[model samples]
Target: MRVETIFEMTSPYRDSFRIKGFRFGNGEKTLAIAGPMRGDEIQQQYICSQIVRRLTMAEQHGRISEGKSILVIPSCNPFSMNVSRRFWAMDNTDINRMFPGYSQGETTQRIAAAIFSALEGFEYGIQLASYYVPGDFVPHVRMITTGYETLDTAKLFGMKFVSLCKPRPFDTALLNYNWQIWNTKAFSVYAGCTSRIDSTAASETVDAIMRMMQAAKILTKTVTLSPAYEPAVVDESELLHVKASHAGIFYRLKSPGSSIESGDVLAQIIDPYNGQCLSEVKSPADGIVFFAHNQPLVFENGLIFMIRGM
Candidate 1:
């Protein structure tokens, strides 16, 4: 296993803080696995590094006999990683939105392009992600477009649910867009929230990577995986959004992943100025609470939570 250190730019905090990655196995079939482009996404990066360490150890001991190459980039943005922010340092630009990258463009575009160039020509790609928004999202794989054999690859990940999606212009996210251009077979494995770390989500993501390696015949032993979810696919449009009815301090009535019926009390917004119950946010439909905001203080037009039909 050969490891490489690439730097997007020199950081002021630490001189030439490098981005760490590993290239393993001298085989024809290549697998590129990348973690969060956002610095705050530490969990995703940690899990990817774990995968690399395990694979490297196995290869060192001659345990892995399969003829396949693997590349693991644990973290992409060191500046953001330092401050635990989600965007780049030069500007608060989201690197995911910039694709196939630009050398002469903005800071984010330059870095995004550099990462893409470094990751070119992989037979399979797995982009590990942490949900930046609220709620403990169920582990799932998201495909960029439809009717590609890549959708079938979800089975190998051992994830219960998969979300089929097409990226919009705003969604020109680096990984998704790069996958489209490179024709690299890829998917986004989203495990937990961005601002927080969830150990369960991290384990699930690591297991998913192992499943993929097993399918590739990289590991000789059988890989055990959890059963697929009953409803294997969730459409992006079907994610029902629930909003606050009035401005107040909210008291959450339920946790995410709990089944809900229409009119179920989702939260209670209380007037902060006075000890008065301002309003109650109820479930809009019979479904599972997929996401909830951390900010208990709510405004009249604030989005409270989201539920997806079971």
Candidate 2:
């Protein structure tokens, strides 16, 4: 096992910003795993830390395959993480939106360029990712539907689902998309929630990552058990969004990963001042809850749940 600083920026007011990577085994660049690029992604960071810990143990026990090297970076933007900000502290920019970046463009661009430079030339890239929305997701592997993507390889992660995302205009700058264009098989892995750790979901993600490494022959041993699920393939557009009709305090009854039938009571909107139930949100179709709003408050027409129709 080896640790190295892949990117660094000096600061007069604070500690230098450094992106450190933990490498296991020695040989070809086989895989690269990255954690949070956002400050509030505590759950994402935790998942990557667990991957690093397990890989460290695997290297010690000679479980990492010979002629295979894997790099795991636990966090990319620790400066923002330190202050609990969601984006770049100085400019309020997202590091994730600047990928395959310009070295001379801006602070985040330089950081992105440095990090992406270090990440290149790997057979696989896995990012412990979070949703842009504040919500809980059923743990799954997601991929941008670049022409080079293959769902078969993504299914190797052994998560419950594999989401094929149809990229929007802004997606061209994403690390996962750029990695795919650069001939790397990239995957975005989501845990159940962000900002707080979910032990059950975190354990499942760690197991899935190790299982993928073992399947790719980068590791000789893995902590994963017998395959627990056959991944359901879903396009991102297929999800049914259930929205809040009234602005109020939200009371949710369903969570991510729950199976629901049409007309099931999903939630209720409560009048905070009067303590009266203003409205009830119900499921419109039989499906699995792919995502559920995590916050206690909601606005009219705000997304509450995204169901994967069965």
Candidate 3:
């Protein structure tokens, strides 16, 4: 295992900031796994750490395939992580939103450019990603419907679900979208939650990546998937959005992975001062919950749950 600096910037206030990459095996570039670009993605960073550990043991045991190279960048924005901020510590900009970035642009853009440049030329790319809202996700592999995306490559991870998302207007600047445009097949893996770590989800995520590596000939050793999974390919149209009717304290009766029928009481909003039930949020369709808000407070029209309809 070799550790190399991918990008670095001198900081007058403190130590220099550096984005480092861990390399496994030697020869052609094969796979690149990136971790959190924002500071609050503790779960994302933790998953990437586990991936590094897995790769380390694989390399030490000579399980890594010959003439194959894999790189893992555990965290992209360490400064924000250290300070407990989500975006860039300096200007509060998101590193993720600035991709295939201009070197002469803002600080975050420069960082994005540097990181993206290093990730190019890989056969496959995996990002430990998180949702925008504070919530729990049913661990899955997410793929953008870019013209270059191939579902066959995404299924190699062997996760329980493959979410096919159509890129929004701003998605053009995201790393996953840019990677495909640059001729690199890319995937984003979400492991249940964002700020908090979920061990079961993390383990499942690691196992899936290893299984993919083995199947793709990046590893020579056999990898067995636990409990077995026949992943469901789900797109946005199959999802049912459940929102809160009033703003107040959120009391959830269901979580991600829960199965619910139509009219099921998913959650209730309580008046913050009076402790009175403001409104009850119910499921509109019979389906499995794909995502659920876990935060304490909810605003009117806030997303409470996303169910994949049966």
Q: Give the per-residue lDDT of model 1 (tens digit) for 96-190.
A: 87887888897787777778887778878888875555545666787766345376677677776777766666665656666756768877887
User: Top model by TM-score, which number?
Assistant: 2
User: lDDT of each prediction vs. the true structure?
Assistant: 0.74, 0.92, 0.90
Q: Which tens-of-lDDT digit does each residue in 159-180 have in candidate 3? A: 8899999999988889999998
Off by over 4 Å in 3: none
* Candidate 1 deviant stretches above 4 angstroms: 11-13, 61-65, 131-135, 146-149, 223-231
TM, every model? 0.88, 0.98, 0.97
Shift of residue 44 alpha carbon in model 3, Å: 1.1
Candidate 3, pairs of clashing residues: none
Top candidate when judged by lDDT against the true structure: 2
Spell out the clash pairs found in candidate 1: 101-113, 131-194, 160-229
Model 2, runs deviating above 4 Å: 222-227
Cα error, candidate 3, residue 144 (Å): 0.8
Give the candidates in order of TM-score, highest first.
2, 3, 1
